[model samples]
Target: MPFVLYAPVKDGLHDPSIAKQVTAFLSKLFQDDTTPGLHIEPINNAVDPKVRTGRVTQMYRAVLFKLVSDGVPHYVFTGVWPHDKAIEVASKAVLKMNPVNGLPELIMASEVDLTPVVERVARVPVASVAAEFPFLEYKSPGLTLAGLTEELGLDPDVAEHAWVATSEDEVMELAGKLGGWRGEALLELAVGATIADVRISLGMDTAPTVEAEAVEDEQLVSAMRTPTAQMQFAWLEDQEELRRVIEGGDLAAWRIFLHPEQRKYVEAAYGGSFRLSGGAGTGKTVVLLHRARMLAKRNPQARILLTTYTRNLADGMKRSLRDLDPSLVLADAPGKPGIYVAGVDQAASQVLGSASRDELAAAVEAVLGIGGNRATSRTSSAQKAWRDAIESVGGDLGPELRSPTFFDAEYDSVVLAQHITTLDEFLRVRRPGRGVALGRLQRQAVWEVIRSYRSSAAVAGAVDFGEVCAIAAQLAASGPIADHVLVDEGQDLTPPRWQFLRAVVPEGPDDLFVAEDSQQRIYGQRVVLGRHGIKIVGRSRRLTLNYRTTAQVLRFATSVLAGENFVDLDDEATDDTGYRSARSGPVPIRVATGSITEELDRAAAQLAEWLAAGAARDGIGILVRDQRMVERVARGLEDRDVRVRQVSKSAATGKDPQLMTMHRAKGMEFTHVLIFGANADLLPAAYLLKDLPEEERADLLQRERSLFYVAATRARDELVVMWEGKASDFLDAFTAKDHVR
Candidate 1:
């Protein structure tokens, strides 16, 4: 009855069988530590007298450290290992309390030998060593060894080891060797985090006040309770919770352990709407899922709506929410009093689906200035409608204004965005982010085109999804649908979608929460949230710690947007800076072949090699530019006797090396990725760029780059990019770096 058990979420619990055994052991231990089946025994000659080993199975044992806090026994389950190895680890490892931060840290008695570094340094000339020493600058001022150890609480020995690192890669390797807070601290410092920044990121700045001279166990237990320490250590609440944590293994670790920076946003109480922005894999969506659950738990009756750009991603978030807490009640409709998950359009449809015919007609009149039932209308694509309007009524317009791209954008960016109905209103509205200027005569021509499109849509009773969203916003104004709305991939939402979301949820405390990354904006153009009545001024935060991709892959992915600029929802210039990955892997490999056939052959060989090296077939992806390229590459792989599947709407459900378009690759990650058709013409996709104005053309290029960035970052461990003839101009960013393989 006096037991408090904690477990460190380590990386080795991937085996389902071992996970089950560990789960069973934890259940028995938590229920009663005295259970003989646990075989909980003290390790002989352990460095720390508290160290012990408990039997998890016949062959495996759980290494634990037992401490007493206020007359209660507390155990820390370090990891699961084989019988002999577990004993060895328990005897040599000690859970030490960090003196400066007053937090507990896991340490090993054995230290990495610097003999290899010394020998390598000895072989190099003094000048060469000075040039190659990655951390030589650390010897100066605030970044010195003493500064890291005495000030930041990094283990002195680990700091000394990193001081001798010859390259950045060596420092990363050393960090891996000295795992735990020390490794993370070193990694943070190496990635340009200042000493104070490291403290803040580690949550030490906000940690509970600790008595340095307090009883050792009491201090340890207190440290274990800090948000920073919980990133690696957590207590088991019940057998079911323990089972979820262990059985979910490394893949599900995000649900259990959250970075201190992430935890702040997930639990913070906002007075109004807040925006969370980050790069790919920075855990924005993770924060949304956690925050949704936290909000639901706080008020069981609160109607929380969780929505995203596409139905597929919304569906995925629903599953993730369920995984985080199966007890959560998910609602089938946005108006229901529970956490509702659906795509933005789907949410709009749900609202409109229940509206009366008169309400629907009024909503349509409000949006398009036309009275009709949009549900019964023959829906047409926005592009086709724009083309038909341009060809029929935009004849007098200049060659520049005659483009469907320009007209379609004008309608979204100015017309629907501002709810402009009449030509006079359209001419008066300010057009922000519409690069090309329009004179009075040109504006009149554009209005004529818009009028033509509106007339045709009215006669045919056709409405685009954008109009539906606008209509939903109008209908919801009379009665809001949700008490709270959480949006993911907010960057991809059109202005109409933003208005609909704003209308669905009343403007108040915790009304709207958005998770987006402008750098991953693959669908819609830049939208200023304030223009849509959503104010996040001084209420926005960014995440820079990428938890998904490796540092090398992150570097490669970010380079694609090197010169491009982006703006946030606030309309201020935003940048992709301060991001750093905790892990490091091989630099991406890029190859240029003579023809499409040769490129396919190279991709096939690499895919085959990964499969041969034991990578799971389902864990590898072949991403191409378009669906056509997806089919083509799939056929190429099939021709080579390589079994493959083409996936859309969702990630591959089965094995056999799936292929998909770059757009489909968003919100997914793979252990290995092969971008098979990255040629210059195919990437910018000549068809999309032809006959476009220079500024509009440049905008398309940015979207293309973002698409490539998404595909490149989807790779978790390794990435291989192949092209026929000349590679895409995006590859030029790769050649500038030493990572070109």
Candidate 2:
């Protein structure tokens, strides 16, 4: 008969030192030839032949099936598994089996300490043994066998056999003898014997089980009788206590509520794909960072892929990750498994190579009727001449070309028209190819156009950054690079981008985590991850806690998003540990005159005051609607002797005034915020009045709402919302309630 040794320890399997010792002990037993047919399987970290991880439940289920199928009298080790449900299931499976012909003798080897099992079972100690293990230290010296039996409430005679093992060899010998008890008999014995009884029988004396500890911690003589009254009264008292703690922080409470729910969700959803959709200031990036950290801890071998629409955001995320864990190696992490942070086109181009880049540029230039070498003065003149010839050939340049808009203001109409014509031609080239090859070329052309518009260095750098996603999607959908694709900002993706992501990932719901919120999309675009067969596994969870902003800041900002799907924490009654509030900060919102000069003066004055009050210059931000506005503000602030950092989409460097467009300010926090150009055409016009359908118009409105949400929440202690001309239409509805003077 195979014997079973039940060694329960206080620590869990996560302890590397303890786990190693357990593995060593098991290895010794399995290696002994006398222990025939004894197979010791350490399930933790043991890879499944099919799956890559040894996930506890899967292994236990396999073990039960094998026990029933083979009917071998083998010895199985069970100590490292964590979840109680898995243990319960395994125990019940053993009870159901007929011991004579089915199932093996299970030996649960643990550090001679039984505090963990005692805590789990809420029982007392019954036995003790003097065995030296490097990982454990026994605190209760000179503990007697009689004392153990009395503490556990176990019958002394039945518990006598528990202390039979004096050394490692004897423990193994004893484990083999008790391995094969029948189902009903084992159940009866387990129920009759408390953890104390088992410990005394196993030769441990001073083990304090769960029941004993509970008795020692709480007095048994409490006068309260009714359970409901005790529970209700206690809950009310706890709430009152929590309210006091929250109120003490005053305006800084919201940041405290930000992490708990986020951590819980990430823990539950670890190693799986799911979407995280929320409005701006809902802690999406915070959750993503925390999720990355947790995933790093759980699956150390898995690589992490972090990509964003812009190069700046990607760089920012990489910096933030480094801040969170300095030792993290981004290059070797999982899912290709390390950190590859770049814009979508940059990533795709890296994979697709120069041939694709050249083809795309050629297509873009051919369609635009521009010279191939537009970067050169000669090539630029040639393009101008070619555009004039096209116009001479009756190519009616549209009204948009003749009349300048925000984007066309800096360039001549003929030049703009040439680029437009080129884009149209490139689209036409890929229209017939339609499948994988066409998609790749179309994607390449999109990026090529953007690159050409943005830079003179390469065709890929001339087009606008937005077009990069379109091209990457094409390559992902139908090219060799379509094996595994991960996308961030799923909500901001356009329809074509969604199609591209769908075409790349493997066919299943479990393969993707589409995290996007319709309300938080500030780009005014519509793309559904689920519509394209991406499996959305669970309900969208709301992360309403504001970790970056204080209670006052959260209140003012959340008021704007009020009727939308959001969770508003009473930030005034919460606490965010380790974050300090500005000592003499003004109420976050400020309304000033529409004049650019007047606004700049007031902004400069406020900034000087903040700096004098000890706010770090680096922590202050001046946000605007466009690059032109940024330059205007920078010049105004610099003239006043206030050093400024200008962070423009195009400029890419510098540390004066931190002049940033509203979109780039997402996922960043500032101690003080000064928002300029809240005027109608500038604030909402960039997105609101485009030549798109009514549905698209509504989508833009939602995006605008989210954009404002982002701007308002960026302020940790102070916020100022100012405008120059007619106020934005977005503020009209809110302005009625004295929100703006």
lDDT of each: 0.81, 0.43
Could you tell me every candidate's TM-score relative to the true structure? 0.95, 0.50
- Model 1 TM-score, all chains together: 0.95
Best by TM-score: 1
User: What tens digits encode model 2's per-residue C-alpha lDDT throughout 204-275?
Assistant: 232222242332111111101112111101111122232322232322222222333454555454243466
Whole-model lDDT, candidate 2? 0.43
Q: Give stretches of model 2 more than 4 Å off.
A: 1-212, 215-258, 269-272, 296-303, 332-336, 354-487, 507-510, 537-539, 558-586, 649-657, 686-698, 735-741
**In candidate 2, what residue range of length 10 has the lowest lDDT sum?**
228-237
What's the TM for model 2? Answer: 0.50
